[model samples]
Target chain A: MSDAVVLGLDVGGSSVKYRLASATPSEGIPEALAQGTVSTPKHDPVAGLAAIARDVTALHRLVAVVVGIPGLVDEASGTVLRSANLPALDGLALGPALSAELEVPVGVINDGRAAAVAEARWGAGSRERDVFTLALGTGIAGSHIVDGRVVDGAHGIAGELGHVVVEPSGARCACGQRGCLETVIGAPALRRAWNRAGGHGSPKDLLSAYEAGDARAARIIERGAAALADAILTLLALVDPGVIVIGGGLASAPHRIVERAAALVAERATFHRVPAIVPAILGKWAGAVGAVSEARELAGCVVGASAG
Target chain B: MSDAVVLGLDVGGSSVKYRLASATPSEGIPEALAQGTVSTPKHDPVAGLAAIARDVTALHRLVAVVVGIPGLVDEASGTVLRSANLPALDGLALGPALSAELEVPVGVINDGRAAAVAEARWGAGSRERDVFTLALGTGIAGSHIVDGRVVDGAHGIAGELGHVVVEPSGARCACGQRGCLETVIGAPALRRAWNRAGGHGSPKDLLSAYEAGDARAARIIERGAAALADAILTLLALVDPGVIVIGGGLASAPHRIVERAAALVAERATFHRVPAIVPAILGKWAGAVGAVSEARELAGCVVGASAG
Candidate 1:
């Protein structure tokens, strides 16, 4: 029974989330251990990680530890190649660093990929063999799940959907890419869009205005939907997953935004059956649940290694 | 040894190709049994299938058959739901039909998906865990291989990359959709592009001319490359496959066209490494080899079931 326990960690640009869970695929998310907060060491990610690790190690008998970070990670080599937000994470062997500190096997995954795993396992994509999960958080990201396995790129840096150029000469993204959908749809982008439109409000407020039929708010939601729809349609053509799970803070917008995005994707999908566009089921627990799932996966790898 | 042989069939809109191979993965491609042509069924469609059954029965024995067709195939149910090209195939239980005719179990798959399986197992993609095979033929189609398995959609209709819209209002496609990459990059579109450039040459002749530095041919190639690059860059954002196998007739273009297309895709990729673009080595035999691979997979399923 102790082997079923796992420590799952989701390290965001501004916050750190963790969950303790039973590692069995059928086991429900453990409720006994849960802790999270806005990471105070954003300026010094290693310090923040060390603090997080100190907290995580207190949980008894972890089967494995899993962490998802916002960056290009070479999982095979256990190196964080790059991330603008977490500068200290770059070049760090995150898995070994945390593993040494915690004295347990650790598995590292891309945050988007971890979210996709959560969705594929228990959310809208539960029944799908192929699934795409989109996270519209502070920045946009996506993960491709095929046949129940994440499509980790050859160099272990897959699912960088946020940086894809929708327009050749559009806005410049912080990633040094122009016309990226992230610039047009991410949370920061949403605020900028609202400010540019002369609409003074937060995204939630904008959603309320949009519900009240404010033309500017509606236009803002429409633009977000259109950008999301285009990317979804493009993904539909390639991945053709059964369901698309839209998560992150942006997805909490009014119903019209999700409806419009679904309609647009449906309209453009030709050769494939338009997949279901649904909100992710994990909600606030997505990162934590995903981390536990990652831990379970790593446990399997460990068992396989020991057997071999 | 004959008990190890299975018939592999690849059905297309206008033609049918086939292969005969042993049931084991290591049996590889049997050179002597590689046989194919445009599938011709004289008289009634049922009669045509009977004829194919007879030909296949005459050539192989003792293992299940695998068929890859251009349509929406439910592999579990052994049904072809909607097929634009083969009206005779719609609503048909292809597996039962072939099983009844040949007295053997059969597995059916989408041709595009089967092509990816072939590549992942034995062709250009064998080296990578995540690879994509795109066939730019009469239609622009693709299949993804992630961790050595095809990501069959929940409904078995994933990998419809051609149907994804590159332009919201670009061109009408045969699937009753507008702006599909197929409408802009397929063979007919490429031919029209060549014609629009006032080049009175076949695809072959145009390739030679481009190799020899013909301005008109170069322009046409450039246009095709742009469309293809746009579609590829978009897909890269979603799947982030390590390698993309460019197959089918259009890939026959001289090295320059391929290089140009690669450069365009690379230029558009963001943050992540752009996938390596290369021609499929299996050429016309890809579908046949894929069919054989599918047959082996199906036979394995049967053996596994019997064992269980």
Candidate 2:
């Protein structure tokens, strides 16, 4: 009972990264006791969770699990509402299934929002009440935390900033719109930009090249940063948060993109209070960390967290 | 005391519209007892309020007054934070000063949000909780009322949609931003389009031409509708409200714009719920009517209102 540990699973399109955190982590102690990653099963998420549970249980006393998905989630029912990339998980009662498998209380949330909760509570945005967290992954994931809680609009679709139409005539987006911020600055766009700029392997490669003073890479990064600034301007014009916390894949190299984007936003802001822009402190583990926070709340461990 | 009427004043750049409403009007009885308009004093808003109060008090038993200004307002201090169009009223503690002048309790609010309060409680948005009210007049004014209250974001500049940059590479705005929605769709733009099309005395003339099936006017209307759709889509992608109430000068031509904008938004929506778009019923009187509501609220008549 004293060694209770919570499992945090960040479910992504390609892989599932996990962290085992103390149920009641003490001050000066690392929250994440152990962390690892596993290839996400293409079709059977249940089997994947079962396998992870089997392995994690053998090592430590597992109490509860919190799962973060890169999609819309029905928090009340713990159902993955819609996952474009991870369709197999969509419409599944993920929490119930996982809870049944692990024999523990399970919590689920949108991965972006999960990251925001982590940042809002313990990371870059801890100092602020209103935080706009942009998680730049395979797709843009946005979460707006107002007064330490993610704003759920009339239809539970508030803070979906990735879909903000940036250019009506630019390009067709997967969301049946033209020129969403996602179309311009999402990971797919970054990959296309990287390939178009003659850099191969990954977005990291493009970032490396840009950092090393490559002309084409610089242009690509510049364009991305500019687009990000445009998105920030839109957000500022509407929400006017106290700070913006950048996370996910792109934020790993904050110096490459966040700096330029912040500069561009400051230059463009006319009637907006230019908020403090900072990279997330939780890094790649933000989703997992935030999921754990939700899990702690779910197990009745966290006092004021919204839901499990 | 039963005959005590509240004076509702809507202070615009060019005119001050006042409405005399019964302080305790029975349900189903007409709320507004009388209404009139006068040119706004260019040099001194204080003198303007004093003149109105002096006249209103002489005619009827005036209990209190509510004022709506087209600008950012510090509702707590009753100070006009910023008014771009009416620079005369900027930085003035209009409520306290006017209360002193009129010798009555005064409530002040942002005109756009005041209009939204009218719509939300007694107009098109009465049936819904989350309402996005877009008042398209000389310049666009916006309000997002979440759960029957206006969302005053950080710095109280939440719903400033006029400055949302629609085109990053478009024309420079007065706000020092490029291609603001204001630059493309505000009154000047509409007037320019009308003149450029070789016909125009007023925007109403262009609207008449548009209604009469003039090709150039139709094109201009279509462009405005498309831009409205773009702005609506941005709003939907972020804060998907339950209903969108279109008020102000443009809503008078609802069939020409609101209907077309709704269709465009519905057509473009992929991951958004197409909300009901309706012309505001209160029309130009919305600000004044809502100002009365705030006056009631300020006098401690409203039990749940945030502030005056």
Candidate 3:
């Protein structure tokens, strides 16, 4: 069973993380299997991913591979529709490319949804039947999971809660919309708010200032918290998940954003059941863990169908 | 088979509608089966529902009964937790009571969700895998359906999109919140807005006046339409349904609210897929139709479990 392990890869803008796990993830993580990371080629992510796959397979007998990419993916066809970070990989058949190079079954998924899958299987959402994970970093993204399965929706883009318009006239978003939740709560938005308030600092510095009781930092943090609370309440009204796992850079900071947002949600959610808000425990390896889970699920389905 | 037909009851504030559907709803409406309505007793809705069930069963055998009510319902426990209009029925075990009297399996659902089930099974949402139905009448309500089944969420109140806050400081909502989607888009809200603009007329009259290019009516309609568009776009970013069915009295009016909403959504949706916004076709019988569908699904689940 140990010899039949699968490889999971999480490809980001600057680096790619990889890990090996047993084909069935629920059993436990494989012992002493070294997790690895390599710098991603800025211009050729597909080739970079194939190299990583080769390096991982050199030491382990890989049965399957799953890659998590930051992009709009057509999972059914294994195509990367659009990736803002890795633009060169746009329109590429990533899964097929990797499978042909590595000679194993391959799967691909959106990175945000991958984080949700990871959380659902091994993090804060593990015990819940329904979970919504919001990743707040340079950009905001989300994933909705029901009964341990991520809802891919009709177009495979169901969990775009970050783009939901919470303010109709606030700020312009990268997606060309105004007042998107991301426009107000994304990390850049928080930094921008702080800078506009006569504070020149990174998001981390801003959080430290907020913790130190800087009035301007508190005001910026309050605005972000309010926007996040509104978005969470909107999600509660729509998705009604059991637990909302907050992940990424901004939420993981010690600024108490999640606590403040939770309080605001409790205050406003009179007719709806307020969900438990907690931090993501899987950390940076969430995407890799979720990719492995997806590979295992795919393998299980194929085996079940063959047996039937 | 006719003797094994099921009965669906939709209990409203002032009346109850009953229909006898075949054990399977996919086969289409039963030919010539009498559908009836009776005035509901002001103080005893359970008794009124029981009487309606008896009346329907008198002509046709009922193997199962499903009731749709306007309130918070615990579907699994067959309890009505709260009802604003039918206060007397609050906290009553309506499903068990009706099942005991009618001698059949019973299922209870919220009326808004019932409308969603009807649309998903036999109306506008029939062809879509993911559908969000928004019922805009006396109050605004919604249901999120994924792969032909309604997502009841963790607390069984997942589709309360009507309560999502659209404006933070706009208007007070009945749910003790300010600026809820219902506060701006419900029929009563539109009426209030119209009346505030120096117009005294029914909702129908307001629509007619808007159609005739009355400036005040247009202003009111524009406000309502914009608020509705914001709510719909919020839903799209969160739920990402393939189609959105607009139902209830306000939606079905001849003033083309759905068309206007669809246009607004198209104008604002840049990155997200704008779902097809259409009016529901089931009309007044939607709740009854949905109740029957739920009963059939419930019956099928029982049979499957027992056989297994």
Candidate 4:
């Protein structure tokens, strides 16, 4: 038995996760030798990265490692340019630093892009060639996967779907833009939309209310779906992919939301080829799967590792 | 003079364009090819394809041939699933038919994606690792390029920027979706936007008036830029490319429009590294250049073709 193993790490605004696993090409299970999550160290990216490296190294013997960060990263350069949520990590040579600490080939990627890689290789998106992953987390950011390659634009930023404006003069986005889709569709957007719809409750409450036939809740959900659909439809018109994978916390929304969003998209999209909208299959382990997947690829494994 | 050449055809909704005598890759001239544009056959798409095949075969001696269609084309399967503008050509075996007709290797691609190929290789987008091309025509469409390859989603549809809704409830688009950016940002949108601003005139007239400092004209231009900028910024947050090349007729709008849009994006996009917004270097001929460039790639030249 080959004793080769790779360590995958997913770093987010709130937490950092790791998995030690063995993988091979054409396999999906990256047999996890160990797995765990920790509160991001110090909320400072550099400290956070160092802490993550230390923890993962301690857990297992790894042949290679990969990290997924939550900000603008130059995957080609292996650096984290900046992240508002994890400030201390800005301008850090994360890949090189980790490679030095762990004494193995290390890789870094955008969390969303990494998740897309996971999906493309081993998840629902495996069926299609071009897949756009919309991570409806605390904020809405996305990754566009074309030809099995994630789009890292000229400046290493390409899939900013959340920032696409859905309201010309609507809500003020954190980026200072008005009425971004992220403002209307992300978790915070859902909350605001619920509030605007005259509700005083969490997203779950509003969703439950909507499911129970409350017109106001229904209206909020409808509005959010419609806005998201508009964005998705536009994406369809631009890049008619076979399917769209909607992930993150928002994936918890009822099938009705996804259906309605798809309907809205089908209604506006003209080119006839509409992408099927589905929830991401990777679930909570998407980051871990993606991170290890990247490591394996860096190690010249053309196939996927099985999940533990 | 190694007079290597390829026949490039851009099959649009209303017409078919042909270019002949392209220069070799070593030669510096972007596409040293003579050109021709003839009305697409007045008959249906099947007949039109036959017509194109006849024409292409007539010119097969040139080297290779490539056609850019306006629909959902599965380049791998060589199937045209749906094309709203060219309904007659839907579901045809474009590559097989043309390849058989010309008795040579042929390539078929989406018009916008083809343009991105051209721009990425020979146009202004040459420097960026991942670049996006936004085409503002009778309707708006876009293409994404990553690692010098077109971003074809799982279904061969990836760069549908126009359909993205900048306004969720703004207006109904031809695709049946309301508030799509194309509904308000393309030429038709510009015309409608100009009219809504209290002017009954063509886009050219409105642009002239705006250029002359007419308040109404200026407002229209300003509003268009603002809306467009909102879209660009949002995209920036999704996929931070190094640069964005603006194409289509509307790009001819006053430079102020691009500047103002950039300003709006800078203000609002917070999460991702922003890229510079620049005018398209390849003009109307971008599609042709891109078509020829794709054909050149298929023909396997030593040096890659130019994109711009």
Per-residue CA lDDT of model 2 for A87-206, tens digit only, reads 899899998998888787788898888888888877898888888887877777777787667886778887777888766676788877777888877888878878976788677887
TM-score for each model = 0.86, 0.82, 0.92, 0.77
User: B87-129 in candidate 2: lDDT tens per residue?
Assistant: 9888999988988988777888888788888898788998888
Candidate 3: C-alpha RMSD to true structure equals 2.9
Q: List, for all models, the DockQ compared with the true complex.
A: 0.52, 0.60, 0.73, 0.49
* lDDT tens digits by residue: candidate 3, B1-308: 23456777888888888877666545553332668788877676666677777777676656777889888898888999998888888899988987787777888988878878888778898888888888888887788887668887897777787888877888999888899888887778878887888888777778888888899988777777777788777777777788888888776776555567678889877877887888899999988888877877776665331221
Ranking by DockQ: 3, 2, 1, 4
Which of the predicted structures, 1 or 3, would earn the higher lDDT when compared with the native? 3
Q: Which stretches in model 3 have alpha-carbon errors above 4 Å?
A: A1-3, A25-34, A39-51, A58-61, A303-308, B1-3, B25-32, B41-55, B58-61, B303-308
Error of 1 at A43 (Å): 9.4
Better of 1 and 4 by TM-score: 1
Grade the docking of candidate 2. medium
- Assess candidate 4 and give its TM-score to the true structure: 0.77
Candidate 1 residue lDDT tens string, A1-308: 13446777788767788877655555444453556655636665555666676665454456587888777777776678787677878888888877776667877777667777888877778877767777877877777776557765565555666766666577898877777888877778888888888888677777778888889998989987888777766666565667777887878654566688898877755556787778888787677777777787787777442231
**Per-candidate local distance difference test:** 0.72, 0.79, 0.79, 0.71
The predicted structure with the larger lDDT, 3 or 4, is 3
Ranking by TM-score: 3, 1, 2, 4
Model 4, A74-191: lDDT tens digits are 7777898877777777888888877776677778888777888787667878877777777776787667775566755655555667776677668888877677777877777787
- What is candidate 1's TM-score against the reference? 0.86
* Candidate 4 per-residue lDDT over residues B1-308, each given as its tens digit: 23446767788878887765453454332544367778886455545655664664453344566778877787776677778887777888877776766666667787777776777666787777778878777777677777667765555555666766666567887866666777766778778778887888778778788777889888877777777876676566555667788777766665556677788777755656777777787766777877777777766653333321
